[model samples]
Structures are given as C-alpha cells and as structure tokens.
Target: MSNLSDIIEGFIKELLEANSQRAIEIQRNILAQQFDCSPSQINYVLTTRFGNDKGYMVESRRGGGGYIRILKVSTSIEEELKNFLNESIGDSVTLNKALDLISALRERKIITDREQRIMQSILGDRALKGVVYEDRNKIRADVLKEMILASAENDM
Candidate 1:
C-alpha cells in the first residue's frame, strides 16, 4: 500500500497533469476530504514536491477567498545543460536536481532511452559506493560533462 505522502504526491501529480493551470486551492479541500487528512498535509506535499529547485513555482494565500497557485516552469534541456556547465556545480549536486536534469533531458529527447539507463546505472548510489558525498558529486559532474560533450559532438 502506498503511504500517505506517496498518495498525496500522486494526487497532486495527477492534478497537474490534468490541468496544469488549476490553482492549488481548487483541489485542496477535495483532496483533503478524499484522503481523510488535514489541510497541512496538502501543504507539506506542495512544499516538498513543488519546490523551485524541482522546477515548480508555488504561490499560496491564506484565509477566506485565498488560493494556492502552482506553476510548472517549462525549461529547455539545452538551457539546463548550459546552466550546469556554467554554474559552480558543487562537489555533489543534490540527487533531486540531478534526477530533474536527467528527466528534462529525456523529455527533450536530448538523450536516448538507452543512454539514460546507462547514465542512471553508472551514477546510481550503489555504483558510487565507498565514495564520500563530495567526491561522488565531483565524479558525477565529470562523467556528465563527458557524456554531454560526446552527445554534442555526435549531434554536430
């Protein structure tokens, strides 16, 4: 059985997929009622899943007539790649950001399904066993850079 958090996440994901522009408040009460959970439970899901780093922007209001607005920031994989290349990709990028970037690339068709699987396998925590977090991040960045460079060269 799915946990409450997972259930809530799935519900919110469905809502976003069905109507990306729908305000969060529109479904809050209904979702709470359906899940038999408190309003704050909904809030917790929103904060954790719809965070800025996850490429979602959430705005909410409190009190009567208040609303919660959720926006999916559509970002290009090429733009994200450029950002990753230019920014100080610290010793270990958070797992969430790395996954988000990979997902974006897959969505944009920048990476083939096979390549994604390979990359995932190589960068997986198990593969990085014995390495410290910081070192693992550095290794991941190096590997990612190499892959991106090869992909670019192939495209050229």
Candidate 2:
C-alpha cells in the first residue's frame, strides 16, 4: 500500500501537470473528507512535501475562508545551474548537507538521475580521501560549479 504522503504527492503532481500556473487551495476539512484522514495529516503532507527547498512556496489564510495555497517555483535550467554554482562556491559542504541539497534539486525535477549519480561520485568521501581532504573538497566544489555553469550556458 502506498503511504499517505506518496498518495498526496501524486495527487498534487497530477494537479500541477493539468494546470501548471494554478495554485492549489487546500482546505483541511475538504482534504480530510476526501482522504478519510485527520486534518493534521493534511498539514503534515503540506509541510513536508511543499517546502521552499523543494521549489514550492506555500501560504495559508486562516478563519472561515482559510485555505492553503501552494505555488510551484519554476526555474529555467540555467537559473538552477547558476544557483547551484553560486551555492557551491567558497564553502565546504558536508556529505550529508550535499546529499540534502541534491535531494532537493531532484525533488524539484531540476536535476536528472544521471547528473545526480555523477555528482555523488564526484563528491563522495572516497574521492576526497587523503591528507588534503579540504583542498580536494574545494576543488570538487569548483569543478561542480563549472560543470553546472557550462551546462547552463549550453542550454541558453
């Protein structure tokens, strides 16, 4: 059986595909009624799946007219590449943090599976193992940034 989060994500994806510009107005009462789940469950899905790092912006209005609005942030391939390059610069990203950032990009459909795999390989601890780990990491970051920037430029 699929989990509630997966189901909700699929539903939201379908809705987005059908109308890319449309903002979903989720009401706890209405979603709970449809899914036969608690209102809090609805909240959980929104909080976890519709986060900014995942390229979604969520807003809610309270009271009788209370509704949740989820807006998908659409960025060009160039924009995403640029952002990734900018972030990777001048920083020593830990393995866990790097994974998290990659996961977020994957969730937003900005990076392909192959790209992610390559990125992992390049950023893996094994690749940076040595007395010069810090230097290796900095070099890796620079290389990754250059790759992204080059890809972005190609897309233009």
Candidate 3:
C-alpha cells in the first residue's frame, strides 16, 4: 500500500482533476481524519508535492470554519525559467532546493532527459561534499541559472 502522504496527495489530485475548475477546497482536519493521519502529514504532502513549482497554489484560512484551497496555475516555460533566475541567491543552493528546481524543470519538460540526469548528478550533495551549505547553495544557483540560459539559447 502507498504511504498515507502519497495516498492523500493522489486523492487530492484526483479531486482537482475531476473538478471542472481545476481547484478544490477541503478542511484539513477532516482530511487528516479521513486518512487516519496527523494534520501535519497533509501539510507535508501539500508543501512537498503540490508546490508552486509544481503549478499549484495553496491557501488556508484559520479558525472554526477554516478551509484549505488548492488552485492550479499555468505558467509558460519562459516565465518559469525566469522565475528561477530571479529567485537564485549569490551562487549556492541547499541540496534539497536544488533538487526541487531540477524536478520542476523536468516536470515542465523544459529540460531533456539527459539534461535532467546531468543536473541531478552534478547537484547532488555528494558531488559537492565538504562544501559548506552557504557555498553549495550559491554554486547550485549559478549552475542552474546557467543551465536555464542555455536552454533558452537552444530555443532561439
């Protein structure tokens, strides 16, 4: 059986797909109860799976009648690449965040299969072992930014 987080994520995605509007509203506590998991698990799946880079936005209202609204937003490849450029810090990226960007690029089909593998390999923490977190983050940022630019050049 799939883990609760994956199950919950799939269920929510199914709901979004079935809806004509491509959005869904659900009560977090109710979802947790339905899945027999803690509310934090729902939060984990939403943050890691339905993230902004994955083309989903999450909104929440707290208190008695609180609800979580998930909206699917569309973005062009160019715009997404530009967003990555804008968000990069000096030259380093934490390993997890670099992997997130690589996954996003792959999800958008902005990078080829080979490119994805190359990026994943080079961005691995093991590849940058012994480098401090701050330095790794900046270097990852620089390399990813360059890769994005190279992709753009190929498009022209």
Winner of 1 and 2 under lDDT:
2
For model 2, the stretches where C-alpha displacement exceeds 4 angstroms are 82-97, 104-109, 129-147
Q: Pick the candidate with the highest TM-score.
A: 3
Could you say which candidate leads in lDDT?
Answer: 3
Better of 2 and 3 by lDDT: 3
Q: Candidate 3 regions off by >4 Å?
A: 88-91, 125-134, 152-156
> Which residue pairs of candidate 1 clash?
none
Inter-residue clash pairs, candidate 2: none
TM-scores, all candidates, are 0.65, 0.69, 0.81
Residue-level lDDT of model 2, residues 93-140, one tens digit each, is 666656666677666665678877877787777877763865765666
The C-alpha stretches of model 1 lying farther than 4 A from their native spots are 20-30, 83-91, 94-112, 129-134, 145-156
Sort the candidates on lDDT, descending order. Answer: 3, 2, 1
- Write candidate 3's Cα lDDT for 24-136 as tens digits: 99999999999988989989999888877677889999898999999987666677667656763335667777777777778767788888888888878888888786677
What is the lDDT of every predicted structure here? 0.69, 0.71, 0.81
| Candidate 1 structure quality by residue, lDDT tens digits, 1-156 | 998988988877677778856434455666688999998898898877776545567887777666777877665666655655556244556555566656655755677888877777777778888888768877877776677657655654
How close to the true structure is residue 128 of candidate 1, measured as C-alpha lDDT? 86
